[model samples]
Target chain A: MYVGFPHMGNAHIGIRGLFKALGILTIDLPPVNRLTVELGAKYSPECSCLPFKTVLGNYIQALEKGADCLIMLGGCGPCRFGYFGNLQEKILRDLGYDFKMIILEPLDWRQTLRQLQETFSPVSWKQLIYASRLAWGKTVAADTIESFSHFYRARQSRPGIITGIYQRGLEKIDKAYDLASLRTIVKEVEGEMKAAVLPFEPEIKIALIGDIYTLIEPYVNYQTDLKLGEKGVQVERSIYSSRWLKENFIPWEKKKKRRKMLRDAKGYLKNMVGGHGLDTIANAVRYSREGFDGIIQILPMTCMPEIVAESILPRVAEDYQIPIMSLAVDEHSSDTGLQTRLEAFIDLIAQRKKDKKDYFLSKVHEAS
Target chain B: MKTKIGIPRALAYYAYYPMWKTFFEELGCEIVLSPETNKEILDLGVKEAVNDACIPIKLFHGHVSSLQGKVDYIFLPRLISMNTERTVTFCPKFLGLPDMIAALDTDLPPLLDMRFDFKKGKKQGFKGFYEIGKQLKHSYWAIKKAFQNALHAQYEYEKLLAQRVTVQEALAYLYEGKELSKPVDYSLKFAVLGYPYAVHDRFLSVDIINQLRKMGVTPLTADMVSSKRLAAQAQKLPKDLFWTFSNQVIRAALYYLDEEKVDGIIHVTAFGCGPDAMVDKLIELEAKARGHVPFISISVDEHTGEAGVQTRLEAFVDMIKLRREQ
Candidate 1:
């Protein structure tokens, strides 16, 4: 059983597919949101967010799905997500949810020899490598198709239908497992899809900021990019196909380009300015420079990075004269209210562009 | 001859360095700290710390490793529980740090666990640092005198602080023999409630003072808050506080929120503390529900790289700004 939070916007189906392909029983969890929060809060210790929700949710969900060993995802950067597995295991065990947990800390090149020795000692190298590759491929496929769907949904005509078609085509391409063939599929189908979403000459451009997973994944964030695209907005995300490739693969050493996967998260972690905070600010500056009409910052309720971006983003918006809206999502997040606010924000941007005036807008509704 | 004491420049480093540095120096011992929390040091921490441990705990290990060859003794404060009641505790990683660092860094110096309450005296008793001093071959009187001087300096520092002098500023006044007066109205006090180190470290990733000063917001360190006082505040929540530091953090936030008269609160914790992970949502929810005042939670780790911490501080300031504007 693999436990996950809506930490990022990753769809579990593809990941589950990889697990199943590896001859393992995989349970796909219900998309995380406010409901997951309630369930997680009910059983989880009082304070932890991703862990509380994920541990309890994974336990109950996996238990419901009749899982054996509980596996959770992890990272070693700003989010503090790395410790979730151990912490979750302890908390759940105390509550009578007995299960095993796997926390795959990102490889640090310096510690590679030792970390790998420990990691590979437990699992077969073939299975590990295969699982990793599948995950990597799926991340790209999910991110790209999800973005394409979102783009077509909000900004294009007949968003719901056109995006559905685009997603279907993208999925077919993903299953190909080969880049050339997939590219061929896209070359053949993309022209018709782009033609379908017409009036693309001067659509409003929106840059997403906050919580890399939420901004990238469609399942958790409700295909926000697709929704915006169908509504006639050009969705730009910091995560791209090439960057993921460069980070994951570029063969290092005598092969010319560095081919070895970066063992350390130093580049990503020590960046200090990355995470959602750096990503959002950098993207905000980039979007503003690109003359983007607006920016949307999305993150979890307890995230620290987005909270930081929330402070400086207003200044960024002011400087660029671009409208910005930030949303902190949790289980209590209401779809209707969220959509209403997004709609209002979009309208505000469209209105500001027409009037060329300073139009301050807010999506944040204080509990008070 | 002065025995050298190694203080790792990590977690507890940011929190009690001044007190530790001054007290140890006053004892005529050489104080050497592991270099500032950086990539190399943090990597060392991750290597030495338990695989499942939080980044801070891992970093603490790296700090210990760095100080091993250089110092005769390395200080790893094993404060088990500070609250009177068994309700307050620290993260599991903190509780087991001595064994963890010792296991990983075999080349490390004898771990000096300045543990306040690890034994029966783990919660409600005075720590016999005099015994620790004797173990380090220092005369009990010298240890007592050094402790007394350090304690006095800390108390006087607090007096100056109550007059609105910061730790750094008070240090200056004490060192330079200058009279100190607060320029700002000790008004608009915001509690810096979290782990002690993250709040105190001026140069590391999250510069809370600069963050506060940038917006004219007065920052208060959580260290000023006693955990026993905060633990009394934690009675509202029904659960065992296993992680002692987190217990203090919880109590501090709640006490400041309901009783300390803080206008708002900011909780800075190592991003992955289980004890804190156990409580952040409750803080957010509590801050939201009964909050006439707001709470801003910040997570700091070596990975924070400061710029990210700054962004969060800026965002938190904006939230405060928006609230004040309204």
Candidate 2:
């Protein structure tokens, strides 16, 4: 049986590695493209968030490619993500797609394991442990590679080279079967990224904050992170899928970092508003305190949590003395518009940086 | 001087105002309610609230703004979960409504933001109220008596609702001792499903229920169905939906469709509501799969024109009538 799941940045690499170690043949669904967005928007509830539409599109594409089973994570929240599987299953079934859908809720691993055992060829405990470890390693490695690429992308003189290296590195990470090999592959990728960077370029750091899916998925955000990096801005994401998995699934994982974020957000937002709403606020504060240049919040149109964050963000921005630009994306969001916005924002920040430097130099001269 | 507590007549106020009013009044505090939603309030909400928030959230912000400086403390409960058996929560906006208000307008009256969650055991839930009582320096006995009275009022109000009285009618009868008016029955019964805030708020929903009455039709609502029945209907789904209100709305819609109780169902939804986006699809699919009960969804935002809503309602009622004639 061929397995399928939705794409969130390089998350598919980890999923592919996990299923492969279990001797499962996973279908490599094509990356999210215009056709995928079109198909997803066409069938999904008009007001549902972008992740639902794009993921539904992924499932449809996978089903058409002869995959008979799909697995999706479930959330428990005020977030609509928790119910995506239930509604998507009904929609797909209504549209006549005959595929078994498995929704794995967080903290219900035993049930998921039992279901997996029932559906596929039985795997020994040893193999299961090995598979999960490999999946975790690959996910972490992919995330590391992504961060390295983001750093190198801004400093590299040539356009598209880092993206190519990033893609090749992902391919290598996907093939590694154990932790040792995964580490080696990550180091190799890091070395290549280091070698590729040109002489020091003036760094204008921007925090990429918003809904996890929109922030991670390149196609959805028109590759805003990469675009900003290409335009010589260092972009750091607020959350990563691997980090999210570790925080939610691993019982031993200390959530001190997330707690700190909550504390930072306390002055602005009092509660966890579900999704990445609280994270956006906390990360913005963190970035501002660390002297980051600006913040770009990318969210799907009608996203509930981000909307709440967006409403409070202006205050956070004002109090912190940091520039913030919120971009609402939907199926109709054109890359040209996004690109223009990114360029304009970058220019504004760069000019602000220059003005600050000149003012500091003038102050020093006056003191002398 | 009597401590004045402001309760914005939006969101949970539509359902739990009587209980809250009873509790506060019993605690020797005067209650102040933001007026029934008007154009000015909606406009204020739209202006103050985040642009991406649904009309309900925006309206909620507007109500709080209207109460600024008028009351000593604004009551904005951070409603997390309503379910005891499982984890069902309010929309994230509800969880952060107090914070949103505090951030939007710093000069407003101090907010009584209490975290109300039934999922966190009975003791913890009571502690939320206990803390509120302590803040007001009320004795434990007084708080206990007030709590009991509030619960009784809420139970009675829900009973009145189940007895076929509209929320407004039930509230009026319970509070003012006004006689409950029997609603005029028409041949066509349409189950109007939505959160209480969206369905009962006259201005927000463009008085859809009264509009239906004018068209010679009976409007059935989620409130008329018992919570027990709604919960049972919800169990029919693969899993429980995350939000309490969404589950009720969906179950009410499902009950109508499965039991063949209504000729048609209309979902009055705030345009950008996260839960309704899913609930609406589920109900629509269920209605379509059943292939007998017709379903219509009316999306309302600040810009929702009354004429547009009326046109849609008339068309829907007309279509249902024609289908019946066949």
Candidate 3:
């Protein structure tokens, strides 16, 4: 059985590595592009959020390439994501596609294990352990490289140099056959990123926070991080797939940070509005306290939890005196509009920082 | 003078207001209900609420705004689960409503934000009511009696629904203690599916039920169907929907198509509603394949024009009528 999964940043790379290590055939999905978004929008519910449509489009593309089974993460509601598996299955069936969907629900270990056994029978416990380790290593390496690139991209003298290095780093990590090579590539990339010459320091620091899908998927978000980095702003995203995996999949790992974030979120939001609603609010407050210049909240247009978060975010921004820009994106979101708004927001942050510095200097002068 | 308890006449208010009213009144609190949604209220909601929120949630914001500074405490209960059979959560807006309202920059009364999760039993719900009673300084026995009364009233109100009374008519009768006129038979039956707020609110649904009635069509809503029957019909699906109201609407549509033999289905959903985006498609697909019934999904929002809705409804009804003749 050839397995296929939707692209979530570099998650597919880790997934492919895991399956390969387990000696299984897997179908490489085509990278998400305009065609994927168009196809997804055509088949999806008109008002369904961006992630649902794009993922559906990805599945269709993969299915055409001989993928007989699809693996998708499942959620339990208050968010549209939980219903994606069921809805996508119905849509695909209606379109006359033949495929098996394996929805791995969080906390449903028995179901997950059963599906895993059915898919990979005659596999020993040792192989499972080995494959899991390899997948984890790939994910951590990919995330570390991507994070390093964000810092380097903002500080580098040339515009595209860091991005080029980051892409090459990812390619090398992807080609690595085992843990040793993956570790070597990661270390080499880290060294290269560190040695890069910086012409000037990043003036503006912004925290990216919101729905996990839109935050990670550059295509859906119009590559806001890249755009921000190009404008000499350091972008720190609060949500990362690697961190999420550690918190959720690793049984022994305590979610101390998550608990603390939720506790901080209590001042603004009392309940789990589902999806990363609490995280969005909590991270906004944390980033503000940590003296970030601004916060950008990006989510799919019809996303429920993000809407809730968006509603409460203005107050958080006001209380903390931090500027926030919320971008509600959908398939039809214009690239030019997003770019203009982002540029204006960055300019505003830069101006505010200069004004604050001037004010502080004047106060010091008055004291003297 | 009694302490004023504000209740926004949106969301679950149409279904549960009678109980809340009775319970609070028994606790020596005078209830201040936000007036029926109007253009001004809707405008306020549009201005104050986040742009992406559905019309109903926005209307809820309007209701809350209207109650601001007029009452001592706003009774905005966080309804997590109305049913115990499955983990049927409400929409995210409902779950986070109290926080949303609190975060609003407007001057607001203190909120009695009690959580109502009936998944286990009335024990949890009663505990919430007991907390409300304590806030009002009522005795335990008094709170218990008041809780029993509220439940009885809610039961009676539900009985009206079981007998096929429209929610508006039932609510009027329940509040005013007036007798409802006998129901009139109509030539065509159309199952109207939506959340209680969307369907019951005169402003939100554009009075679709009455319009259907004028066109010689009887509207069958989810509330009219017995909960047990709806649950049973919903069980035919591969898995239970997570949202309680979404599950109800899906089951109602399934029942109407398979059992009620309705001529057509009119599904009124809020624009950008996540649950409806999924459930509506499922119903539409089933209606086409299995039942061969014509289904029209009406997506409502703050900016939806009444004329457009009317035109679409007329066209849908006309097409169904022509199909019947054929």
| First chain of candidate 3, TM-score | 0.96
Clashes of 1: 52
Which scores greater on lDDT, model 2 or model 3?
A: 3
lDDT of 3 by residue, B1-326 (tens): 89999999999998788789999998889988899999989998988898889888889899999888899999988888776865578888888888888888888888898887788889877888898889889999999999999999888888889899999999888777788978898888999999999999989889999988888899999999988788789668866788888888999888888888999999999887888888889998988888478889998988778889999999999998898899
Candidate 3, residue A270: CA error in Å?
A: 0.9
Clashes of each: 52, 0, 0
Q: Write the per-residue lDDT of candidate 1 for residues A1-368, one digit (tens) a residue.
A: 34332233444535654565455655556655555556676765433444346446646666556555665554443344544555566555655765555545444344444543443335577876776666566656555555565555554555466666666765664465544555566555556557667564545788876666566545446667766765677787866543544553455532332222121211221123223454566667666777888888877555544544454555566656778887766555677877888889889888877665333222223322
lDDT of 3 at B23: 95
Supply candidate 2's per-residue lDDT for A255.
71
Order of the predicted models by DockQ, top scorer first? 3, 2, 1
Of all true interface contacts, what fraction is found in model 2?
0.85
Clashing pairs in model 2?
none
Q: Scored by CA lDDT, what does every candidate get?
A: 0.59, 0.87, 0.87
Better by TM-score, candidate 2 or 1: 2
> What does TM-score give for chain A of every model?
0.74, 0.96, 0.96
Scored by TM against the true chain B, the candidates give: 0.77, 0.97, 0.97
- Per-residue CA lDDT of candidate 3, range A1-368, in tens? 88888998888788989999999889887678899999999999988899999999999998999999998888777787877887899999999999899888875769887988887667788998999899889998999898987887889777788888899998888888789999889889988877774767788899999999899888889899899888788999987789988876666553676677678897788877778888899999999999999999998988888988999999999999999999999988989999999999998988998999999999999999
